[model samples]
Target: MLGIKHNQHTNLYARKCNMKKHLSALVLAVAMILSAISGVLAEDITTCTDSNGIVYQLSEDSSYLILKNAINTTGPLTVPSEIEYEGKLYTVKEIASKAFCGSTATTITLPSTLTYVGDMAFAYCPQLTKVSFGRSKVALGNRVFAGSPNLAGITNYSGVEKIGYGVFDGTEWLRTKSISTVDSAVYLGKVLVAYFGNASSFNISTSCTSIAPNAFNGNTTLTSIDLSNVKSVGSSAFEDCINLSSVTFGNSLVEIGSYAFDGCSSLGGEITLSDTCEKLGAFAFSKTSVETADLSKTKIESIGNGTFKNCDYLNSVILPESTKHIGNYSFQGDSFLSDINAQNVLTIGYDAFRDCSILSDKEYFENVESVLSGAFDGTIIYEDVNGSALVIGKTLYKTEETEINLAVADGVKSISPYAFYAAETAQLLALPTSLESIDEKAFISLSDGTIFVFTKNEQVYSDLESLTSGTIYVPEGNTIENENVSVGYITGITITKNPVKTEYTYNENFDPTGIEIEVNTVLNGKESSYNISQIGYEPSYTYNFSASPIVTVSYCGYETTVITSIKFTSVPGDVNRDKNVTSDDILLLRKYIAGLVSEKEVDLIASDIDGTIGVNSDDLLLLRKVVAGLVSLK
Candidate 1:
């Protein structure tokens, strides 16, 4: 039981459309002005049924008729201005409210004598596309054509005077029309939906507060769009318009939807946003030819992801102090981006500056506090030491291609992560005696490179030992204790304890009759127990424990043991086990306190001996005291 309704107000858009004849042109005019103002009911009511079984409530005196409902079916309806009711001719003055509110009629033609269209009379007519309004049809009701998204072209609305609100509320016809002239501007209520006239550059009407999404999208002819009075621009509103060069924004625009100006490659002039713009949507100006995006005067708090991506010609960007974050890939592929002034930025997302190859080291780290990985991939870095190293700020990155016999420059105390990473050309690396610290992966991938140590300092060499490959060549007179390089025992090594022979022999037949094996700390997944009776021995055999790995041993069941060693990674109060405290221990302590030290680098419990809470200066001071012989681990 579907029905139709005509609301009490009319759509005042009147135009002569030159569409096909089968598609009837509708004329929606202002509501019943003459009769309502004059306070006159044209005729008395009478009921009648047409030959097609359609019911009509007619007025007897004025011959006015209202199609109330159809008995069998609704038609591509034709409402005549006059109809014979019980042989009495009645003039159809108006369609009553709810008369055809939800009718499925595909076409409707009104008579010239019709007037006073009632509230919601033709509302919710889904298939009611072709509609022809009579010259006398005047008044319209609210939502008269509401809920009809496909209601097609309407005809001349020249006779219209007062239009009601929401007449075409749910229709797509309102959004697809060209902007009409000032005398015939088409509007959805007060909102101007489209423009019909020819103008190279256009100004949105001051009467319109907002421009609908895709209103001017792909409109190639529109060169410049001035939105001085508009409050918001919808998503993709001006997208793909290659010729659109300039856009003038009003003070009222606060929110820009995503992809608003994407692919406007020829768009020129600086994208100087107003101070009122707080939210900038993703890809808002992506791939545009704008030379600069000076956001210093605006309130935009963050630059969205891929916002300026692939804009190869963008030379400079000025971010405001109000901006706190830069989204991922925001400035990626902006090859010409040489200047960026984000002095107040705190966090930069991954790949934000990737492929922005021209940005100098000074501009890259100006105000950046934390950088996600790959942020500077494929970017430029100045050589901190000419012909020696490619540098990011004061941190040494990698050496130049030609320098294989590396002499890490003096004053370079710390080797930054990935300093010599993947430099297969580097066959020999010579460390300076002044070198203080080297971060992880600083010497990674230099597997075949020979490390030359100028400093006899064991701690300095220890930091470099596990990080490099091949043999390390120490300077003449520099002693590398064999215990610093080997750890644990290969099978068949001899055990000599005090008060016994310097070399021990094993017999397979005796089950621990003379010698006993006691296990202590063992490397992960390595052997912890051994059957002494089955153990084979060699004369004067020895196991050099690298970093001094120690194990207790007994000969002939005596408790007196002769072997002694220390493991640097597991040793307490000896951060680097250089046999003495120096700047290395203090540096490790500081690194541990800074959350930059890994457990494999130092024993946590050994590092935090004071045991207050997290590692701090007090623990460092206590460790220094132990190093100074004021305290002991026991």
Candidate 2:
């Protein structure tokens, strides 16, 4: 029995040793698994310390830590414009390319010092709906928020002149949005045109005088304009605005620059021009397809070159009676510009009315005298006249043409050097025979068929007239010919040399008349003491200036205080040389002419008479005597 118990105890001891070994194996396996799990968790979010001993972020040492990375973290990242990590202020210059492509941002407010933004920096951020840029000009990088399915905000800063190419490439989910004024301010900073894709419409404020060039260009949604306060419209300010349909202006608007509404073919409104407006710049309303222009009260002074170049729909226009100037190519190539009623215009710039063919019945202005170079070069006026274009030789002219009663105003003596060459607009023209000269290129730039007409030098001074289609009567014995066409496309070309002709006859006649005067002095007293009581006389009236002077007149008891100042009645007189006189005297001319010659002058008519007696027949006699070389009158 003792031997059996010993054997059982040994078995129990063996079993305990086996249990201990199994427990050790289980603990070792569990420890290995726990270590692996811990390693995976730690690897999930990598970390890296910055140069300032502050941790930025990290996956791999070479990975970038931009504003929007691939990391999925609940974040409200604040990127300071000027980073002050340690002590130095470094610009957080770039949000690397495609950096924050799809970040979940509630609101993104940028700092002021930011300079560059990487392309598509904030693209496709579903939760990022609002963003505000500080003072710095924000360049809308390409595809910044392209696929943001729920994006709803639109920037309207005035400083961003150019919305970068494809800035909203895939922003298809935008809803319930209008451009913000801050965005407009940004656009202004960039001198960019205000487009209507983001903003439904636009009407410029009165305070804003000029719309920047290309300001509203390429905006298909631009519908209408109220230019009440706009005084000037810039070049190409609204080019290619397919949706622009109407336009109206206040009296304050004066000038419309080149390409003002070019390519705006949808326009269909009447532009009312106030008399207060003076100039219309190049292409002011060209390509607008305007139906009418109200110029009843217009007193336009100048029309810029190409002011209505391609506005083919307008057929009739009524210019003001005071219209004076037209710029180069003012109505060139306008297919429908049929009528013009320029009244007192003097100068028409180059190619003023080229290609205007349908204009047939045009007779409104009177006092028609001058036509500028290429004034009607390629218009129907140039193409239809039976003969050659009119010849108005070189020289700047002040007064322009009217429908009747021609008269050239001052500052203008002749036509432009190349006024009308090779132009065949008129077959016959009757010029003022009093016209002394015709300068070079006076008959240039015309069709080849027409001829210049003139009458006898003296007869032309008669009533001014023109034969619509008839014979041309040039000066006698003069060699004139149609200008050579070698000069490319020259119209109204007629070259005339200043030829010597028979001298004009003039007659002169003169008649002489004489007057004499003699004054008899029968003074009884050696010293005459007589008080002169004479009313004032005008400068035009004759005075006894060189009459003799007595020492003293008969002092018959101090006669009634002898008031020197008195109102006297008289006829009219000439004082100001305006050829008439009344109380409108300048008050000084009478004194200057009344024997008041200064001794410094040698040629003055000096008439010295004593004021001792009244101005009677004796004084008149003395004045006539002076005129008869008996005395001098100053």
lDDT, candidates in the order shown: 0.58, 0.45
RMSD of each candidate?
A: 23.1, 27.9
**Per-residue lDDT over 525-611 for candidate 2, one digit per residue giving the tens place of the 0 to 100 score:** 221121111111001111121121111111111111110111222212222334333233223233344545332221111212223
Q: Best-fitting candidate, measured by TM-score?
A: 1
User: Model 1 reaches what TM-score against the true structure?
Assistant: 0.39
TM-score of candidate 2 on Cα atoms, chains taken together: 0.38
In model 1, the Cα lDDT at residue 401 comes to 47
Rate residue 251 of model 1 by lDDT: 81
Runs in model 2 with CA error above 4 Å? 1-197, 203-209, 365-368, 372-374, 377-380, 388-439, 442-634
Task: Estimate TM-scores for all models.
Answer: 0.39, 0.38
Candidate 1 steric clashes: 46
